[model samples]
Target: MNIYIIIPAHNEEDCIALMLESLVNQTLLPKKVVVVNDHSTDNTQLIIDGFSSKNNWLESISIQSSKEHIPGSKVINAFYKGFETLDKNYDIICKFDADIILPKNYLESLVALFNTDSKVGIAGGLAYINKGNQWIYETIASKNHVRGPFKAYRKECFQDIGGLKASIGWDSMDVMLAQYYGWVVKTDKLLKVKHLKPTGKTYHKSSKYLQGEALYKMRSGLPLTILSALKSAISKRSFLYFKNTVLGYIKSKNKNIEPLVTVEQGKFIRKLRWEGVRKKIKI
Candidate 1:
């Protein structure tokens, strides 16, 4: 299967070289890679250019965007910049972060899983974040969730979800949308990748409300949104986050922002969330 990768990098000078080297050594090398240098003021472009000189499949594009590390939207926008340069003829498409190191067999194992299950739409590995000299599971999210940093999607699944949302919950949104389209989402525990930096670290503080805004935009409704907000707060052990999320949701509602999914799709999302809540209750 032909695989193509897009990495959206912003001020990632320190880790880009290591990430590229890991990819270069992949047992199943990607056919093409485009790293969108999203307004990076660092030496990120230099590292990418150095790699591009050695690897034919590797390339880079530079874009000038806001200096603030706004997260989701910026990353997705950068992905699109790189996406426009590539052909649409690929079996698998990956959106990788700039500060990650994959195992040599990472891509190889993922391709094997895709080959095994024809219905599998989205698949990737667990993310291990640095914790006291040990790389531990980033347990903030469920193991079932394929983290945004290392997401790999089957071409059909990528298109089925209308690509990715340029919002806070874009990562979660893709999985939900994939299931809505009857595609399987799987996480390979064996393919754990090294996450060089912690997530949500670079996000602008002002963007905290964006998470709640995301729930509202996804049509999560009041009940699910409330539950989501609490779970997120508890996960991070932050009451402030809980408060911010609720406020964000209301703010979005007041502004009458657009919903990310259709009415039918929203219904599916609600049902999915309800099932999850019930499962926890039963347990």
Candidate 2:
């Protein structure tokens, strides 16, 4: 499979080299690796250039953006910038976070899954974080859902989902949208990629509200939205997270934010959410 990987980096000098090194040593090397260095005041560009010079397939581009890292829009914008630099010849397209370390066979394994299951639209390895002396699975989200840090999309599926959304919940949105379009999204529990930094660890306080906004934008009505908010609160072990999420959803509704999915699609999403809720209750 012809795979192309894009890394959206902002002031990631500390860990970018380790990430590039992992890709460079991959058993299934990507056809191209483009790192979009988004206004890094640090030595991020230097690091990318240093590696890029050695391998012709690896390259980097510099672009300007706000210093403050806004959740959904910032990274997606960078991904698109890198996306425009490549041709439409790849079999799989990956949007990788700059802080993760992949095992040598990570891409090879995921590509195998894609080749094995023709219906599979998006597939990726699970992420693990280091704590004390060991790295364990990051259980923030379900293993069934593909984490945003390591999302790899089959070409047709990528096109079918209308690329990626700029709003929050894009990672989750992509999977739901893919399922809506009759494509399977799979995750390999065996392939545990090392996450140097976990999600939302460095995000601003205001970023928390974006989660609810995302749920609303995806047309997850009050019930599912509340359920999701509560689920998020449990995951983070904070009642405030749930409260803020509900507030965020209401705020988005008041602002009359556009929904990311169609009315029909929303119906499907709601059904899916309700089914999961029922299953959990039945258990």
Candidate 3:
């Protein structure tokens, strides 16, 4: 089956070449590889151009220029370009971040999973962050991680979900949306990809922003988003730990409560806002 690989790159001149080289070395190479240059301010375009000229195996390599200043929009814009450029006959579409090195059998494993389960909409490999850095060979969620780094989908599954969301945590969004539509989604433990850098940001802050976005989405059709997150936290003991830390606040009785406005507070407030103040009081 023919598979198309889409690599959305922005200012990745330092890492793109290595990524391209890794793709060339794939045991099961893709039918076509398209790198979307999200109006990169660096020589990323030039590098793609140089490689595309020399590699005959790399079919239909194209560069798309984006005008969107926001990173999220740039990602969606690239998907637009890919959707327009890719052949409709391909069986599968694979998405990859520009900074990862895929195992040789990565593509093969994804295809195998799709063949095994016709209902499976999306499949992803495990992500290893900074094995070369301080954290080495840490099994980063052997399964169910559903990372955006390296994943594949049946072409029909992608079409059903209407393509990438273009927002942060787009992969997870796609996974949940697919599941909501009764499509099976999973991550393979054997397939692995190595991320090159150590993340400097905090997960809690990111989670807070995601919570706010979840609230925004809940206003539409999904009333169960916050409940799902809270359920996940509680089931995993994260909420219990958090509750232990904030136990005093629960007992403190304040008749007048102020609305939250900061980023983190906004997420909490937005979640509560969606649930309504009256519903919050009942809890």
lDDT of 2 by residue, 1-283 (tens): 8999999999999999999999989998899999999999999999999999999999988999977777888999999999999999999999999999999999999899898899999999998999996998898888898899999999999999999999778998889999999999888888999999978887876687898899998899988999888887898899999999999999999999999999998889888889889998995
Model 3: how far residue 158 lies from native, Å: 1.1
Position 132, candidate 2: lDDT: 95
Cα-lDDT of candidate 1: 0.92
Q: Per-residue lDDT tens digits of candidate 1, residues 1-283?
A: 9999999998898999999999999998999999999888889999999999999999998898878877688889888999999998899999999999999999999898798889999998999998899989988788888999989999999999999998879999999999999999988888889999988887888798998899998999988888888988898899999999999999999999999999999999999989999999995
TM-score (C-alpha, index-matched) for candidate 2: 0.98
Model 3 TM-score, 2 decimals? 0.68
Which residue pairs in candidate 3 have backbone atoms (N, alpha carbon, C) closer than 3 angstroms, thus clashing?
A: none
Q: After superposition, how far is residue 42 of candidate 3 from its true place, in Å?
A: 2.1
Compared with the true structure, what per-residue lDDT tens digits does model 3 show for residues 1-283? 7888888877788888888877888788788888877767898888888777877645333454644334344566676676678778788888777778888888778788888888988887777766434525434233665676677888888887777765544555566556555678877777667776433121333233343343343232233444544544675568653343233122221222222123453444344445653464586
lDDT of candidates 1 onward, in order: 0.92, 0.92, 0.62
**Model 3: residues with Cα > 4 Å off, grouped in runs:** 57-71, 131-142, 198-211, 218-283
Candidate 3 structure lDDT: 0.62
For all predicted structures, in order, the TM-scores are 0.98, 0.98, 0.68
The lDDT, on a scale of 0 to 1, for candidate 2 is 0.92
